[model samples]
Target: MKKQELIHLHGLLAEVCNHYEELSGATVAHEEYSELGIRPTSIHKSKTDHKAAVFALADGITNEMTEETKEPVSAAAD
Candidate 1:
């Protein structure tokens, strides 16, 4: 895929992962850096690992956001 395609795919994957994590109330863990962001090189790793890591981070952010919002989580829709 072209660079732009890859970037777009990465974003879509992240959004899906975030939605999953928000609905499931699960914590997703991945690598993080204090000063610099995730290494650009790592972003292009073998598809499996790269995708997994991206999703995991998205999940983590989603979970955190949900918790901070203080909204009650329910399995059944009201």
Candidate 2:
């Protein structure tokens, strides 16, 4: 896939991750921990990991794009 596509995916992933994180935090602030439904801690951990991975991938893609698009420096500018 192209860098632009990867960048788009990365942004979408980040947005999802952010939403999950916010939900997790909000859940934890409540005074009740009902024994029904999914656990907030687990969701938080999962979202944190996913966000980190997405950032790493985005960084790698950025590096690759830069390397592939480097321009030669003009000696006259030196």
Candidate 3:
């Protein structure tokens, strides 16, 4: 992915983590790392996993959309 895309994904992951914390009453400690000026390794891993899952979901949606369009590849090539 491009740098912009990766940044966007990171933002999305942060949003997801915030939502998760809100829903489950779980503390996402990583969100507060900046205040302490120390980054936690687990936070990066968590963000990466979240971004990957989001990408996979997007891929699924794209595949579904393509199938639903009913445009044959051969016909489109003509």
Instruction: Name the top lDDT candidate.
Output: 1
Q: Give the count of colliding residue pairs in each prediction.
A: 0, 0, 0
Which candidate, 1 or 3, would have the higher lDDT against the true structure?
Answer: 1
| lDDT to native, each model | 0.56, 0.44, 0.49
- Alpha-carbon TM-score of each model against the true structure: 0.42, 0.35, 0.39
Best by TM-score: 1
Q: Which segments of model 1 are wrong by more than 4 Å?
A: 32-78
lDDT of 1 by residue, 5-47 (tens): 5556666756665576688686444444212243335555555
List, residue by residue over 1-78, the lDDT tens digit for candidate 2: 544444455566446545644764531221121222223233433444444455554454445445555696576954
Kindly give the stretch of ten consecutive residues in candidate 2 with the minimal lDDT sum.
27-36
Q: Residue 22 lDDT in model 1? A: 80
What is the lDDT for 72 in model 3?
63
lDDT of 3 by residue, 1-78 (tens): 754466466566556655755775655444233333322223444455545555554454445446555656575544
Candidate 1 local accuracy as lDDT?
A: 0.56
lDDT of 1 at 57: 62
lDDT of 1 at 3: 49
**17, model 1: CA deviation in Å?**
1.4
Ranking by lDDT: 1, 3, 2
Query: Given candidate 3, what's the lDDT at residue 30?
Result: 44
